[model samples]
Target: MTFFTFVTRGLTRRPVRTGLTIVGIAIGIAAVVGLVGISRGFETSWQTGMKSRGTDIVVSNMGRGLTPKPFSATVVERITPLPHVAETCALLVDLISVEKADMMIVSARQWGGFSWKNLKIVSGRLPNDAAERAVVLGKTAAEVLGKKVGDTLQLETEELAVVGIVDGGAVVEDGSVILSLPLLQEITGNQGKINIVDLRVTPRTTKEELTRLCAQITGLVPEARAVIAGDHIRDSQAYRMISAMSWGTSLLAVLVGVLGVMNTMLMTVFERTQEICVLLAIGWKRSRIVRMVLWESALLGFLGGVGGVLIGVVGVQLLVTTPAIRGLLEPELNPQFLVMAVAIAVVVGVVSGVYPAWRSSRLTPSHALHG
Candidate 1:
C-alpha cells in the first residue's frame, strides 16, 4: 500500500484512540484561536469606541490617572487656535452616586464636534442645546437605570431630564450617561473648569506629531495632558494585561496537548515494532521507514488540527453571542488569524511526529522477528 493509504488505514484501525487524540488537539487549538480572536476583538472594539467619539486627541488631567481633574476652560480656547487643530471641546466626567445606584457621568458641550459614527438614537430625540439639566441615556445605561427618554434622572447633586437616548454601539459608552457640556459643568460645580479637552486634528497629523503637539500644549498648561486616540495610556495598559493573560493561558494548553500527541505517537511506534522490522527486512530503506512513520504522524496531526480549527470557530461564535463574555472581550475572527492558526497546527504536527519516526526507523528487522 502507498504511504498515504497505509497511514489512513492505520488511523481508521484505531478509531477511538485517534478520535480522543483529535479531541485533545482540538481543545488546544480552540484555546489558542479563541484567545487570539478575543485579543483582536478587544483592539477593534477599543478603536471603534474611540472613533465613535470623533475626537482625534483626548486631553485629560494627568492627575492620579483615574480621577478626573478639572483644567481651566481657557485651555480649550487656547488649543482651538493652534495650527492643525480643527476643533476643541471641553468634557466633564464624574462619578454620580444616586440612591442605590452609582454610575459614571460623561457630560460634554454640544459646541465641540461629536462623531455620530457609532451613535444611534434608538427611541428619543437628541437633547436640546438650550435646555439646562437635560441628559441623554446610553442604551445600556437606560436599561440598567430603568430610565427612558422623557424620564427624569437625578445625577450627582442635580436632577436632569432625559431628553434623548444614545447608543454608542459599544458596551463602555452604552453604560454612560451623556448630557450637554454646559449642564454637566454646572452640576459638577466646575463651571469654568473642564475635565477633558477633546480635540479633532487635521487628518494628516500622525500620532507622534499629535503627541508632540500635545506635549507643547501641556507645557502651555501643566495640569492638562494629551492622549492620542487608539493610544490612550490607561486603555493600552488594559489591553496589554488582557493580551498577556490570554496568550499565556493558551500556550500552556497547547503545551499539554503537544505532550499528549507525543505520547500517542510513541505508543503507536511500539505497537508497530514488528511491522517496522519486516519493512526493513524487505529492503525498505531506513529513510523510507522514517518517512512512512513521519507521514502517519503528520496525518494524525493534520486531522487533529482540522478538528481544532473547527472547534475554535464554534467557540468563538458562541462567545461573541454571550452578553457577559462578549462585554469582557470582543473577538474578531480575522482571516489572517485563521490562516496563521492553520499553519501553526501543521507545523506542530510535523514537529510532534519527528522523534517517533526516528525511533521506528532505527529498529532492525532480524531483532524484531527473533523477539
Candidate 2:
C-alpha cells in the first residue's frame, strides 16, 4: 500500500480512540483561541472608545491611588481658557441605582466642546441644550431597564426624560446612561461643581508636549491634576488581574488536551509495533519509519486544530448574541488567530509523536516477526 493509504488505514483501525483524542486536543485549542480573542477584543474596544472621545488631555482630582478624585467647579473654569486649548468639557461619573438596578451615570456639559465619534442617536433626538434635563440611554441599558424613548426615569434627586436612544456600537457605552452636566449635578447634589475635564489640544500638540502642559496645569491648579485617558492607567490594575486569570485558565485547558494527544500517540505506537517490525524486515529504514509515525501524529494534530478553530468561531457567535455575557468581553475571530491556532496544533502534534516514533523505530525486525 502507498504511504497515504497506509496512514489512512491506520487511522481507521481504531476510530473511537482516534476520534476521542482529536476531541480532547480540540477542546484545549478552542479554549486558548477563545480566551485570547476575547481579551484582545476588550483591549481594542477600550482603546477605540477612548480615541473616539477626541480628548487630548484629561484633568481630574487626585484621589487615593489611581481612583479619581472629584474636582471643584472653580478648577474647571480656570483651565477652560488655557493656552492652546480649543474647547473643554466636564464629565461626572457616579454609580447610581435606578429602580433597584445598578447603573453607571455619566453627566457631561453642553457645548463645553468635547466630542464623541461613536455616540450616535438612533431614535428620538439629543437634548435641546446642555442645560436640559433630558437624558440619552444606551441601547443595552435601555433594554435592561425596560425603558424606551419618552420614558421618565426617576433618580435620587430628579427625574430625567429619555430624549434619545444611543447606539455607540461599542460594548462599554452600550451599558451607560449619558445626561447633561447641569442635570447630573442636580441629581448628585454637586451643583456648580465639576469632576473631570476633557480638553482638546491644538494640532501641533504631541502627547509628550501635552504631558508637559498638563504638569504645568497641575502646578497652576493645586486642587486638580491632569491625566492621559488613553493610557488606561485608571484601570490597569483591574485589567491585569483579569488578563492573568483568563490566560491561566486557558493554559490549563490546553495542557490537559496536549496530554490526551500524547497518550493517544503513545498507544498507537505500541499497537503498531509488529507492523513497524514488518516494514523494517522489508528494508524500510529507521528514518522513514520515524517520519511516517511523526506524520500521522502531525496529521491528527492538524485536524484537531481545525476542529477547534471552528468550534471557537461558534463560541464567539454565541457570546456576542448572549445578553448576559455581552459587553463583559467580546471575542473577535480574526485570520491571524485562526492561523496561529492551526500552526500551534501542528507543532504540538509533532512534539507529542517524538517519543512514540522513537520507540517504534527502535524495535528489531526479529522480535517483531516472532511476536
Against the true structure, what is each candidate's TM-score? 0.76, 0.79
Candidate 2 residue 298 Cα shift, in angstroms, is 2.3
lDDT of each: 0.71, 0.73
> Across residues 179-253, which tens digit of lDDT does each residue of candidate 1 receive?
776777777677787777777888798767887887877777777677776665344445567688888887787
Looking at candidate 1, the ten consecutive residues that score lowest on lDDT are 321-330
Off by over 4 Å in 2: 1-6, 57-85, 93-111, 116-118, 128-133, 154-159, 181-197, 206-235, 327-329
Q: Which candidate wins on TM-score? A: 2
- Model 1 segments more than 4 A misplaced: 59-78, 90-118, 129-162, 167-177, 180-197, 203-228, 233-235, 325-329
| Model 2 quality (TM-score) | 0.79
Q: For residue 326, give model 2's deviation from the true position in Å.
A: 2.8
Error of 1 at 240 (Å): 0.7
Q: List the residue pairs that clash in candidate 2.
A: none
**In terms of TM-score, how similar is model 1 to the real structure?**
0.76
For residues 212-321, could you state the per-residue lDDT of candidate 2 as single tens digits? 87887788788777766665434445555656767787778767767877788789878888888888999999998888878888888888899989887888778765
